[model samples]
Target: MIEVQHLTKRYGPFTAVDDVSFKVEPGEILGFLGPNGAGKTTTMRVLTGYMPPTGGKAIVAGFDVFEQPIEAKRRIGYLPETPPLYPDMTVRDYLTFVAKIKGVPRADRKARLDSVMERTRISDMATRHCGKLSKGYRQRVGLAQAILHNPDVLVLDEPTAGLDPKQIIQTRELIKELAGSHTIILSTHILPEVSQTCQRVVIINKGKVVAVDTPDNLTARIRGSETMYVQVDASGADAQGALSQVPGVRQIAVTETRGSVTGFEIDSEPGRDVRRELASAIVTRGWGLLELRPMRMSLEDVFLQLTTQDAAEPEVAHE
Candidate 1:
């Protein structure tokens, strides 16, 4: 539903977005992740036609964003970092105004407003002044306005930025529910949110596309060795020796505790499953095995590796 090719955005001597390209298919939710000043917002602005790129092209729903901006934008619902709201207006009035600007027909404005208000759970606050609402309610109001036109694509920037934990969870669930029907490109620094709500991710750093793949695939790619954590009733030294003797075991470190118990982390070659061998070794050595489990890399670890790796090398502009 969205395609960006060789997209570059520059301001004078500095480049805000550097030759970044990616695609988002129908029913796909792509998580756009980056650090502060990473050009995530800049790229989103280019896609939304809020800013034009210095070079290359972007297409939304089969329409070129630059060539046919109005038609492209008509199919996109954008909720920017700050909700573009008129604080003086009541929730109902503000949304009604948004509907008109989005070109909702006069005959359909009322029903459109009603549906969006209900979808965003802001119906109860229809008569309340926007400025008088709490942060959560205001965020919901922003969401209502974004979807007021029933756009095919939703570009949400930090949809849960300032919400409380409960509200964040609710917002994530809402976004998940909206998937399949709406092609969404969500930009946020929250890793857990991406893991929970996005099927694929595109990581950006220094205004360049650093990595792109499903969260699990990215993490699995960086997982060089298999690691297992084991607890047993044995001295640290003895546990290490027994585990080291297991076939395929490359490294082992054990921590001794009182009552002959030990905690150990074992590292072996990638794709190796030595759990059974380790258990057999423990039993033969008369050590009581308390725990044995594989250790998987977390999203944070994967993010750090990919971003840091890119930082060390010369930046490669994508097309």
Candidate 2:
């Protein structure tokens, strides 16, 4: 588990991470999201003990990161944006070195190193020099080292950045497999990754945490009435009129027409489920139905909405 309380980081006039607080339950995957310069990396650095906070506190795996640096660090496995790798060392040697440095007992070092290499699908590369590995293989080596220590907490910063599509998929699957055993804090700009991988998300903006919630809840909490997309085998104007007759329909735009099928973007009254009524009307009018579904807002929409929200909302404050 990981806990951050009113964490703050400042450099003269600029505050990088301001009064941010959040918790990650054991085995939960938390997605840390922000655009460039939003303090995501800064916050990660402080949590990983790479940098100290200007104010506030952080606890990792039951130990204060600042008060008990070694204990906290011992429980964390971090893969930074640019993984720390020794080019000249063979993959096996490098991972063995990592396991030893992380305090893997001498007797268990070999077994642990081999286990991680296998899990990361890097077994074949073990004998090859790290310098000779391809970019994707290098990334795998980075991931293997991070987990080689078998730490309870894994702080991965853009674990999939710059990888080919195949490699990205492979890495995501590996992280998912590690979820139940490792409390992960994943930082990335990739929206799809968050939706697919994280249980909850923390969105940072201008050095402050603006939003924190499950992806579904964030989108469902979106302001304004729901928008639904409908298609019917009828004239565009006719379909629009029929939908307007549905009791909850507030706004209807006949957006497109392809032969006999007409598409409509309908805004419904708040908290209304007008699908049944709309369907009934369409059938009664002998208009053939084609498609109907509510347009759920994507994670990208929620991210843009929260991060660009009016500044009037209070920023999380720290003493």
RMSD, every candidate, angstroms: 2.5, 2.8
lDDT of 2: 0.89
TM-score of every model versus the real structure: 0.92, 0.91
* Model 1 steric clash total: 0
Tell me, by TM-score, which candidate is best: 1
Q: Model 2: which residue pairs collide? A: none
Q: Under the 3 Å rule for N, CA and C atoms, how many clashes does model 2 have? A: 0
Please state the error at residue 265 of candidate 1 in Å: 2.0
In candidate 2 the C-alpha lDDT for residue 260 amounts to 85
Clash totals for all candidate models: 0, 0
Report residue 225 deviation for candidate 1 (angstroms). 1.2
Prediction 1 global C-alpha lDDT: 0.87
Best by lDDT: 2
Q: Candidate 2: misplaced stretches above 4 Å? A: 258-261, 312-319
Cα lDDT tens digits, model 1, 200-264, are: 99989888888888888878887999999999988888778778989999998764466778888
